[model samples]
Structure formats: C-alpha cells, structure tokens
Target: MNPVDKNHWLDGLEASVERHLQHAIYYFQNQDSEVLLKPSVTGGWSIAQCLEHLNRYGHFYLPAIDRALQRHDGQPDAPTFTSTWLGSYFTRMMQPETGKWKIKAMKAYAPPPNLDAHAIVAEFIHQQETLLALLSRARRADLTATRVPISIATFIRLRLGDVFAFLIAHDERHIQQALRNLPVSQDIDVQAVR
Candidate 1:
C-alpha cells in the first residue's frame, strides 16, 4: 500500500479519484478487444455492465442522500439510517475496507444492465456534482467531525474532512475491478506493421 498522510486525507482521496476517473474513461472509450466484452472470466460483469453497476449506486443512493438531507428541519443533520434503508446496501458495497467488520451486507443490489450508456455517463457527472454541492454547502465541521450515521460498521461519514476521500476510494475500487477484467495478454504480432 502506498503511504498516505493522515492529515491531508481529502487531498489524497481527490488525487486517487481523478486518476481512477481517467483510467475509467480510457477503459470505456477504447474497446481494445477483450475490454468491451469478455465472458471467459468467471462470474465477472462486462466493463459496460460494471459501469452500469457503479452508476446504479450513484443514481439511486446520491439522490436518496439528497432526499434524506432535505427531510431535515434544521441545518443538515447528517443522515441516520436503519436496516431497511436502501442507501445502506450501497454504502456497504462501495465501502473502502472489505470484510473489515463493517455492518454491511456481502450482497449487492444489481440493477439490470440495460440502461442507455450515454445517459448513465451523463447522470454520473450530475450525481457527482450533486454530492459535491451537498458537501460544499455543508459547514466545515460537519464534514470533519461528522461520522456516518450507522456506527455498527465504523464507516466514516462525508464531512468535509472525509467526503473527498470517500469518493476517491469508492471510485478506485470500481476502477481496479474494471482493469482486472481486462485480458492479461492477447497475442499480437509486433513484428508485422499495422
């Protein structure tokens, strides 16, 4: 693991998130043979499908956050979740540490991989903007001192202090999964001219 400074965790999260975004764009933009479609891998979702899965969380959960935040009578009383909350399912899957004794289910809520790709991509940007806006509008202390409402999992809430980092780590996990699905080696003749 690369050594990261504890003091500037938000900065580190932002940097990693950007790098992951760059790679994800490249992965999707260029099919490059196996990347676009490969069923050989066991129980693997195609890159397109993976992108779809990633966006499902954003499309569904971020809006839920907005809705929950809106329900507050006072200033942004961060979110409090129960076992029945839909967002909790996603927060667990996209969670940073795996099986680290988090109060999340091992199960994933898979949406059908049939959404329009362009629309999904467009909405992803909008979702990110919405999240950032919510964070930006929050008081600095809320982002720092605020921890995620569910304590059974020990997950950090997106206070200004932790929001950026959480986004970055969340993006990184999916990015790596997409990369791993790519074929390790495809026989190509370098000697022959293209």
Candidate 2:
C-alpha cells in the first residue's frame, strides 16, 4: 500500500469501525438466535460463528494494540503511514472482494458450532467501542514507531498503523461473511455493510 496521511488513515479506520458497530446494533443484535445460528447455504460458518470468530481475534489484537500504545515513548505522531511489505500483503489478503480466495481460520481462531447470538453480538459491539477509544488514544502515539505483535505469530511484530489496517480489513471480511449468512428477507444493503 502507498503511504497515506496519518490522520486520514486513522479517520478512515474509525469510520469503518463505526460502520461495523452500527451493523451489529441495527442488524445482528435484533436477529433471532435461530437465524444467527443457522448454517450457511454455502456450507460456511453461520452468522453467530463469524461474529464469535471476530470476537476471538479482538480478544487478541485489542489488548495488544492497547499495550503497544501505552508503552509508546511520547514521540510525535508521524505525518504519514507507510505499510510494510508484509503488512500490505496481509491486509490485501483479508479483503473480501468477489473472487478472492478464502483463507481458513487457524484452529485456535475458529468458532464453535453452537454459540449464543446475543452474547456474541454484544461482545462484538463492546470490542468495537474499545477499538474506537484505542484509536482515539493512538493519535498521540507514533504509528510507525509503535509495534504490535500478530496473534498468529507473536514473535513477529508489525508497525501499529499496519496492525490497524490489517485488523479492520479482517473484521470487514468476516462481517461480510456474516451478512451473507443472513436470511434473504433480512438482507442489509450489501454496500452499506462495506
């Protein structure tokens, strides 16, 4: 990915987070547990499973980001964020554009067959709220200098900006998948989900 203005990048990510939060509130939160737990027509994960999967990721990345930010040395925020090669690769891989190859969730990240939809949706909303607050706090830290370890591979750390980009992209991918699992009658405007 090309370099982008730091504030611009953060603002875009914040907007994405807000959209996800609203989708959970307006759509998922109101759905019946049976609807959320129904198996996908395509033999994929159910809506509740998708959300629980994302919540699992949030369980890892959110605190990782918070800790990285807390440890920041009070350096001035960078004017621009340049994605590292690996970071860009991961972000692009996570995007849910049509025809993209699906990546299987690692065993640890996979959601169980039966989950309570209400709890999963509530947890997702709470995590997004936490993420929004963290993003606000991030404006004071150096995006490039601060590093967050990846959940899959803790030994490898990426620039904080890249972690934000990759994490949001992953969220969007799964949320889109969750939307697909919805009954056609309850279908949201697909574009709005993005």
Candidate 3:
C-alpha cells in the first residue's frame, strides 16, 4: 500500500486499540475479581486469562516491531507495501470475524490458574498504549521493508504491515473472547472453582 493507504489503515488500527483499551478499563474498574476471573463451565479461559494471552503476544511483537521500525530509520522510502503470502495468510487467520472458530492457544501464551486480575488488566492497558505508539513509529518506516519475526519461530520473518495486521486482529479476537466471558450483571456474585 501507498503512504496514504498505509496511514489510513494504521489510523483505523490505532482507533480500534483505543476502543478496546477503553472497554478493558471500564470492565476492570466496574467489575470485581469474581466476574473477571470466572472460568467457563467448559473450562475455557476467563476475562483476565484472555487479556494475559494478548499480553504474551504483545511481549513478543511490541519489541520486535520497535526493532523493525528502527532498522528502517535511514533507508530510502518505498512507494508501496506489498504483503507477503505467508504474512497475509496468518493475518487472515487471526481476524476478529473468525472469533467463532475456536483455536487453542500456544502453550507459551496460556495464562495460569489464579492469576492476578488487576495486574493482568494493567499490563494489557499499558501494552495497548505501547501498541499505539508503535503504530505511530510504523508510519515513518517502509511497511513492506521492515520485517519482524513471529514468536513461535524467530527465524521466520514477515513484513511490517502483515505484523500489524496480525497483531491488531489478534487483539480484537481476544477482546471479543474477554467480552464474552464477562458477567452480564454488574452485581456479580459467583464463586467459581478453579
């Protein structure tokens, strides 16, 4: 994509991050630990667990994105970004629209039992803000030229645009999961067994 198009996409992604952050903050502030930490009857993840999973991804991608952007600092600007086939495929797989399609989390990304809800929420909020900053830095770089490796295999790299797409889509997916896990009632009174 051209500079204009890339910027427009980043704008939308940043806005989505901001919106997710707001909802997360609202849930964390308004809801108690009982609601946030309650697991599903089928042994699925809780709201805190979902946020922690996203945080695990952020831990990998945020630093990698920062390094990728830095590498493009003195390079000549490219007119357009072309997504790699593998990158595009991964991004498509992670999109929020596919939330109904259940995919098990990698072992490294799974949150443990009895996690601290406040800490997980705080980290997720901070990570979203950091992601927004990274998006701003991305605009200055050539999205097609900058490459970041995935967490599972550091040797494999993808274009910056695809990384952004994957990360944002991944964020949305988990946000949806967390939202679904939330208690409908404001006055939550469940004592969920771990």
lDDT (CA) per prediction: 0.46, 0.89, 0.80
RMSD (CA, Å), candidate 3 to true, equals 5.2
Query: What's model 1's lDDT at 43?
Result: 70
Ranking by TM-score: 2, 3, 1
Please name the candidate that would achieve the greatest lDDT relative to the true structure: 2
Note the residue pairs that clash in candidate 1.
143-159, 143-160, 148-157
Candidate 2 regions exceeding 4 Å error are: none
Candidate 2 per-residue lDDT over residues 13-84, each given as its tens digit = 999999999888888999999999998998999999999999999999999999999888576677888889
For model 3, the local distance difference test gives 0.80
Best by TM-score: 2
Tens-digit per-residue lDDT, 1-194, candidate 1 = 22333334434444554554555454455554444455427675565555666566565445544544554426543232122223334434555455134232224535344445455545554555565555444322233334333222435333333333444445555555556666666333322211
Span of ten consecutive residues with least summed lDDT in model 1 = 77-86
TM-score of every candidate: 0.53, 0.95, 0.88
**Candidate 3 residue-wise lDDT at 141:** 82
TM-score of 3: 0.88
